[model samples]
Target: MLDALIQQSVCLTQHYTGSPVCNPSRAALLTGRYSHRTGSLDTLEWWGLERLALREEWLLPLGGLAVPGDLDHEAAKEDKEREARSDVHEPSRPSRFVSFAPLRDFVFQPAALDHYAATALFLACVRRLRPDFAPTADDARHIARICRLLEGMPLGIELAAPWAGKLPLGEIADELAAGLGLLATTLRDVPPRHRSMRAAFDRSWALLSVPERDILRQLSVFRGGFTREAAEAVAGATMADLSNLTDRSRLRVEPSGRYAVHELIRQYCGERLGAEHEAEAGETAEQVHDRHAAHYAGFLRVLEPQINWRASINSEVGPETGNLDAAWRWVIEQGRYELVQAMVMGLYHIAVAEGRYQTTLRLFDAAVQRLRAQRGRGEGGAGDAPTDLLLALLLFCQGHMCIDLGLLRRAEACTEESLAVLDGIAPGRLREEQTLYTKGLVALLRSWQGEFAEALRLRGELLSWLRTTEVSVWPHVPQVGTLFVQANECASLGFLTWHLGQYDVAQGWLRESLAIREQLGEERWRAYGLRTLAGVLRTIGELEDAERLTRKGLALSEAHQDRIGIGWSHSALAATLMSAGRPGEAQSHFVESLAVAQDSGHHALLILSLNGLGALALRRGNLDEAGQLYEESRASFERLGIAGTLRYAEAVIGLGEVALARGDWSRARARFREALAARACRAWEKMDAVAGMAQVFAGEGDTSQAAELLALVAHHPFTAHATRERVEALLAELEAELPAEVFAVATARGRARELDEAVECLAA
Candidate 1:
């Protein structure tokens, strides 16, 4: 069965030496004889080997024998004839024979002992023989070179051992570099093939068929290792071809099912290919690289969506990141801009989502530079809608990333350029569709920068366009990602209103968008909607509903690994918990939210989280802690160009409360005044500021002034039960401190003050 298996294998090279010496082992194997029967128990008695007794149990060797000059065929023939005459039946063996070379495996590294024993023993013999030599450190380095050249093969080490004794290890290493020609042993006992390393490799090379040789040479192009699919694409090799190479040990299939060639063998194969295609002048090598680049470029696209949708960022795509990088390098170097664009687009989403800011920034910058260069050369943008759209999309993505980082100026610049590119393209519904979404982004950025009036105007325009325009006119392709801009349009409007403190109205818009996203099966956007609506709910005294919505959003964010959504949901959840009087739970969520926001570089989200934490601290009467948190959050909002926004209004209120706790009544009034001055603040937020100033007035024993501010707060809906209770306590206190006629007059005077006059009252 073993003989049959050997016959079926494509190629097999056997060097079985049952007697430990070449001549004796050859005599035994060729004549099917045991060492005792052959009278070759030792190497010294192997001369003129003939007449060996056959072992009945021994199987025939069925592969070709290529003994290059060591064990001569003439000697084997004499042994066969002697065996026939000695009444020993000739063992059945394959008749095919060829001249070939065998490349030896390297086992020189210290770790190699785990896999190879013969090479280890050879090294042991060398060390023992040279005990008195006492080579220098540099000489030890040269010894490593010598080992590499001989690939630590048992025969090669044995042959090179004599030179190591006669010359310095460095000189022996240099001589080997001139190939086996100069390293040949002059001893008459050693065969010519066994004298040098090259002879063995040459003998192995001679046995390969043309197709097998071609496959081996092509496989040298791969770096690291390659999958079978990659091998088939880049090397133009089939499974059967790889299997044959693997069986012959020309290619090694790793346990992971990847194929790899030994480094030395790869170098040898590269040289072989270079020699064969000298006339082609490296053209074939270039083609292989191109195929490799193309193959991995496609691979990036397949894994792109999963990057933001799952936590497989480190598992599935992480390992292939090197290959994708290689592909990008080649594409960029070769000026394959279209491929570069595709690769960049595929990787950018995951890169940004994974918080690989530096990588994504570099890739985006490179892509834009390349695209501009191509356009300069008149190689692109000549009615290339797809490429133009892709370019615009990349700019838009960069703008969004900038927004996350709170770089509103840069965000505006990117979105403006994206919009310009879209406008520069041919006029069409698709262009208009993209223009509306890009406009919404610009508006959102404006809103982030505290330009509420301008932002609301621009967003309102986009909302109008989306409402009047039919969804059928928009591009139906999956590349649109969100498909309908209406959902996002509504969500953006909701967010803007949320900043304006119209919590009740914001909740409706966000809910509408959430329902639309659910119908569209856009889970990522749905998470956004849930988080936004939760913030609105939290502000409007709906703690339980806020917690539920925020938890749902947090679950979705975690499931999708959307760090931005996760951060937002965490802050919103923290706000709900803080309002529910769960300070400890709220503190942890606030910390987690801040950490996530900071790591993700979402400055806008960070502002909200910090403010939430500050509010919680204020509620717990940790005046110093709340003051620090609120001031830091205020600085962030201003740094992001979003000062005076409703978010900032809340932070101002916390700072006022901090002042009130410190008995700095005048400073408390000033902070409250700052929030009341922002006319865009929601009625409830303005009421909170007014109520705070009332507390300051009451602290100063001015019951009449306190009654006026308290009356203004009484007219609006109370968002926080704690704030409402505080206001009621102050109102009752004012009523008890003053005469009924005085309290009634002050309350009526506060009620008579116009909303703007009331806000200006604090401002004045």
Candidate 2:
């Protein structure tokens, strides 16, 4: 699994700086500095270890292993003999013995016990707000990470944590107590670490009064982060009880106008209820999760809009620009994302209806776990159409999540298994169509990510398949996902074309897709659609309009707190700023964009931000800084096995500019030529390379060739841009190579801008 996580991961050289010892090394490691700097000193203690007989039960034995150094000691002989027996049983069988590494049933983070303590405190507040129960420290962290994704929930983790101060968290999580069957536990299962909150939650729950437990029961009705009104309605008690809860910090109200209960408490309440009234509790939990899921699905719907805010801005007396910040706030800071995280444990209908395809997958994983638990009691939640549908839906959703997470091979396997299951069933119109729709959507996503080039062909084939299906299949088919897929394709292809400098062509596709999104009437989505349009507008130099459109998109992204989407808008704004010669401001925006990529670990945007940073540095006359930024971007590109073409070539051009600044003509020419050979693909940014190449030729006394390259720049529709100072400088160098008479003629012929304009030109 660690290797799987590392698949799409790109490694970069990082310098190490910390202590090299054991115990004192922890201090240096924690501070990311040496013990000398951190004031930490060495301390050593012997840890006793001796293997004992009769301690091999799953949990006990895992914690009991105490082996001497490895050179195939006595204990290893039993395993070799077993392999020898297996080989004898099947003469052709290859030996499957691994001499060193032990196969384990569970993986634990030995270095992170302190981290677990910190995480528990953070999750306690969340546990207090939730209705069902408080989870273990481990579950609390998972919940917190998900909750933080919602815009209104940045402080969410602190709201839902559990007590870890009284007992071992593993005891509470009996289901996970197997520890690792083959790996030795570094610490005793019972220890001084047991005094933390993970143990305290169990004690606290046991201490709750019947009245408090009853109040908790009523609280379970509400799912996710709730409103103050919700607590008042569900708590089934007087105003004094509500006040008491608030006074005790058991309930918290956020500035975004939502109320929350701690998740650890919710987990505690939920676990007890299962033993007390199993069937009823399960149904209630399902209901709460379903509603929670439904609310956030609303957030997803708004992802495709292109808002018209000019009316509101114009209606105001002040200039429209001042309202931009306010508008940004109104659009982005909404409470939509909280429900999305709750959806991870939500009911099936909400997931399907909301088109939260990605989250649905995550929720399905939780459901599978729950189902297994239910199975332990000789019961099954699997049943009729809706229940079965949800199950199948979850399988497909999980498959898609794997795909988006960049496990393409695993994604394919999961989706295929899903398709096989669906095929075994009797056809229902909506279900049949949905299966196909999701399949098609994944195919297109693969295409959009530069993984598959035959996307158009595959999409066309899916469309053809849809047409072949009967209208009767409409009831089962998924329409929303399919519609979005069309919109997505148009948007993705539109950007590609814009990059290729075909603005008009790009606009055709973007406008059509944008119009569809506007008609969809989902505010967030319309905003997303307008983003695509803004990109097209910017390419054609409609800076003011592009700014407006992009802000609208950013608002939608913020309203939903969609990290992936928000980062994209940041990049969009930064690019426009770059073109407008606001590199200093652009640099800040690019940095913000890079932060978004860092948050999601999305490779595409991370590299894009680096490139943007490099360009901004060049604009600011910081050549060394530009080179570093370019080098950083190159490292990302190289790790991903992609920069050898576009990004690498662009970085080479940036290097050439740096060399030119130092009067290194030979190096500059070599860099420029090297850049051109690699710049085989179309990209508007390639203009920088062409312009630099012209400068190189002129520097080498190749007047005719330099003049031709300069002419290409001079005639470029975008070349007259106020930010083309670098190209103008290249043209000036060409002029120096020509005779005075021909230069005059060329100047008259508009081969050069008016000298004043040329002198005033700025780099784009």
Candidate 3:
């Protein structure tokens, strides 16, 4: 009878509402096959209807629904068959399938309304419900939050839109935190299940098989999303179960191959999981939580070795950050110290690499305090290698993160405590290696605090000791007898030598360090080496190579999202650009570096960017802005307790240049003298200072003295290219204003003076 009716009719249309099993039956009738075979196993129209195997002869267009690509191909094949049966071949019409879904768009796109078409649907519903409503800025913000909280479900937005007339937008948003109870409608024309979100969820829940329901409940343990492996391990879910849930619109599979439950659905399922239920597997919420924690803990432990060696493994960890965070919190709450120890180092490295400084710091700080409290209770004594080693490692990781964040005092305290903890361990290879690494970190702290000479001495001693020692440390790579600790010391010495203006020595050490790091295949540390080497190249007037190396380092850093590397690379690139006489480009990079440094709380990088910007401002004749920037850089350096460093001296020279630009001869001279007096001042910085003094002398009408000092700076091989260019230009101007014979005599005298003699003469 149904076939006779379909054969007799011109066209047939079927519509159903609020029936849990309607779509599957409709799909079965259309395809003449089992609904499961057609992949149509549920009644949710948006996700399930697309699974139907509708024939090509049917001209009905399903708006806002995307037919799968294979279905389109099937339709084309049927069209060719129909054409072959006819007398004349006809051109195939375009596929009538559209890929737009108003509700699904809201579900899949980012939470921002302006970026998604959901904003239109939301506004249309709002205007229909409350015609006089004009949203203020605050109302718009609340509306966006509402859209996000609802996951852009059309019914939820429609049900909540009517409340716009009865309550403030903020109140409506706040009420949503209470859950699905807040979104219900009284419209009599609507189906009962559609009248409230909970009713709809309940109807869907009743249709799920017991296994499906159990997996759904267990999946609530995840925060963001989970991969198939993660789902299997944590929730005991199979592929078929996940597919069925997805067909029912209970979960969303992202393009990254991760499955996500909607927040509202997750909350509902979480509540169900928490309640009493006789699940066949007999797993409770606590048991599921335990499994979730254990799975991620093991996951992190597997990645710990790679993380310890600073490999480019952040891509593997980034997607699972939410799950790892949830697992960490659970383990800490349950006082699962072994689990905590298993995952802590990996988490710390991942957090630092991703620039989640404050959150990781807070988490680790709490963990440390808890461990200390446990030790105080005599739960773990000094001879307990595992517990003591974990604590010491935690303190060291904390100290390293503190260095990045510019919390110097805290970093010092943590490093010292880490050493103390290691002292309690029995003498062994692990203890010895750990002690050497901790001491290396202490050298780094000292370097940052402007104690470069001491840092150099300490780092050199470590390198010497590692070279003589025959202990086999577990290398990051396959190479036997390669000491990464020795390579690290070499890099430290390179940095210290650079700070002390030993460019030739710095380059040699940095090259050696880079060679070892390249052999290890550590991309993060290799990028560091590249940027540090680029700094030396830029200082020695190799602007092109400097720019090339810096850009390469920047790309590597961006690939891993390493904030410190990104910040430093930008600053280095900007300085190189500035030296190449590209102030405009340099300013943009400096600004970018400053913003990243500020966001990452990298005080040293921030100061470097500020000083670079100051140099650019001075070059552009913006004296007041230059002065302000220099003063800010100086103040920040002082605050970091490294006021005597070469960077601080650079800032002082910048101030003197600003003063010289303003023709404030006395002030410029005083600032230059102050910079020259810095113990950490490099030869190039001293040259810059003396050049400023020449300008001051020229401004004070001492042309002969100015000519001599300018010639001294110009002839100094240690003078930077940009500084030499500026000094030469000044010399030309001065020679034009002086007697020819007198200018020649003064320049000859200046060229004969040694660098130290020239600096002493300028200072006098």
Candidate 4:
């Protein structure tokens, strides 16, 4: 027994693997090699670079398996089909093998087996170290259970769990509780104490009072950390005695006014909520949940900004984590329009700054739902002026997101609706200059949509008004500060001019905006200015300049732990890197950008990052990877109803090329045609698609179609850099078709490698 072993032991001697992974940790654990030394920090993702599995264990002081797997690709179609078939007729519980396929494949288990022996040695040393305090039977039983667990494989322990009920009290309790609060599902035929963690947790649950039980049940509503105010709002109690209740540990007082319980206990509480509710008790159960959700939603709307103020006063000494994370989860998963909008607005605005133009769509959609619901019940409309302000602001926010995705028509509709509501409201609320700011935003978006004349005219109007008005002197203030209004107006003007081919003017405005942002310090709104400034500079072919600016923004975001901001900045930086001719770095940054965007639920930015990465991959001749990237980007765009993401078609063409390489001409043709169709959408998202289709057509021997397709791409009369890409692509395509005798033939990568062989040999 563990207790008995601890009572009598010699000096304890145990070794820990120095490797950081099965690939990295395995080497260290077994051979004392760190990740850097072994070059296996990310070996789990690479093919053949994985840590070697413990082909030979205990070769004495060594243990642990080397991992072997590449995880990026999906399971094979045949495997999935087989699983689907098995799932239908034969319903069997998934074993750890299949349930944790990718993770299990990557983990080294042999090294774990050695940990039990080490623990045993450590326990024996502890007792020997202090003979006066002999180990108890219970202690020995617990240590014994751990040793058994380490010997068994993942499923071996899982399957043996039920037998704990059958095992004797003192027999093999070592298999049960190995780590404090880090319980594993021990399934071996061990004794009751070693049998299962479920029993242990159940024992803990039976000890709480009704009030404490109620607190636990209510807290389950929150999935993340919750604040004290939020707890007060959701827990169905805010009595004066609550603090006393918390102090006694019956309730929990989270840091920064936020609280948390173990995830396992939360799940238990959820089960209790289900069991206690009656079948027809919709009001009894769901209503309470709805009220709870609403309260949390309102709390989120208020608390987020309040927390910022508290942190701003002293972020280093900011209030405890009381319940903020809980509020975040509440907004993230269950929020209605108000809460989600507040949450999005409250974020670091990295999404907007870094060019996560696509991710804000979910919040926009929620706002739409809110608007529709309000309208359906006629809560606020034309005559209801007070309510109309909020309604109009919500619509405006949605329109901004729509504009980000190139959904011009939908965006226009939203803008128009908000303006109509604006017209209906009294003259005293938001500023007149602010209205012009919106007008300018819509105008430039219209230009991007190809309504050049209308857009130009609107831009003129907005700029003229802004120049004429010294400052906002409105009797009533707009919700946003004057500084924000100025920054937004300037950024919008820069964007419009940049697209309209006025590089000098656009750059000037962007510079001013960026300068203003630099002075204002770090905040979500300022991040918007920083990102837009970088984007505008990039458009003017100042890629290096853009890179620095974007990275500056990214650094600020990192300092603030702004997930949305970091994602946005990294994405833009990737594009900047690509434009600066750093494909390898760009590719890596873009992938990380997309991952961050996906994790943050910023769909818009994820779409852009994916498409950008796909383009780089295609350029690098990784056509399979390119296609996957494009497909993923396209899905993100489509799912969020973010239209005008046809630029992803560039990768679709790459897919066609890959198909062509594999001798699948039919598939190649299909991909080419699809790319062409999407590219025809005419937004910037289609630029890559258009160029790609031309390349495909040239490759397929249709020079005339390729030339005609190429005609759509024109030289930017204003700037040499803008037209350089088109010229280069045409030359490369022509060369690809030439006979070796007439001219060298090669693909894009080949052309890059051998410049002489890559271009068409036009007559001198």
lDDT of 4: 0.47
Query: For residues 194-279, what per-residue lDDT tens digits would candidate 2 score against the true structure?
Result: 23223434544555566665556555433344455444544445656655554444454544455445443444455545445335
**How do the residues 1-764 of candidate 1 rate in per-residue lDDT, one tens digit apiece?**
32542232211112232112233211112211224546532221110011112333332222211211114443233222222121112221111111111101122234333232223333444565676654454554355445444433444445665566777766765665433444445656555554454554566777788778777777766544578998898777999999888766677665557775643355567667667743433446667668888888877766555443444443445334445655676776787766775676566665554454544665676667776666667776544676677677767778877777767678788898888778778987667766766787888777755677788789778777666765443324454444346787788888877766567778788888888767766676688888888777766667788899889988877766655566677777887888888989998888777765665566767777788888777777788888999999888877767677546787888898899989999899899988877544655677788888888888998879989878767755533455666777878978988999999999888777766677776778
Lowest summed lDDT across 10 adjacent residues in model 2 is found at 58-67
Tens digit per residue, CA lDDT, model 4, 583-616: 8888777766666555444455766687787768
Candidate 4, position 611, lDDT: 75
Ranking by TM-score: 3, 1, 4, 2
Note the residue pairs that clash in candidate 3. Answer: none
TM-score of each: 0.62, 0.53, 0.75, 0.53
On residues 1-764, what C-alpha lDDT tens digit does candidate 3 reach at each position?
23542442211112121111222111111211114445543222232212332343232212211111113443322222222211111222221121112332243233433333334345556777677766665566566556555554545666777788898877786677445677888877566766777776787788778888888889987866789999999887889888887765677676568887766677678778888443556766788999999999999888876663543477667667667877887887888889998888788877666566676777787788877888788887765677777788788888888877677788999999999889899988767767776888898888866678899999998899888987665343436354576677788788888877788899999889888877766677678888888888887888999999999988888776665677788888999998898989998888778766665566778779899999898888889899999999888867777676546788899999898888888889988988887766776888899998888888889899999999999998778777888899999998899999999999998899888876776677
Tell me the lDDT of model 2 at 643: 46
Off by over 4 Å in 2: 1-209, 217-489, 559-562, 641-680, 699-703, 712-729, 739-764
Q: Each candidate's root-mean-square deviation in Å? A: 17.6, 18.7, 11.8, 15.0
How many clashes does the backbone of model 4 have?
A: 56
Model 1: residues >4 Å from true position, as ranges? 1-289, 300-333, 340-345, 373-388, 467-475, 478-483, 638-642, 676-684, 717-722
Worst 10 residues of 4 by lDDT: 755-764
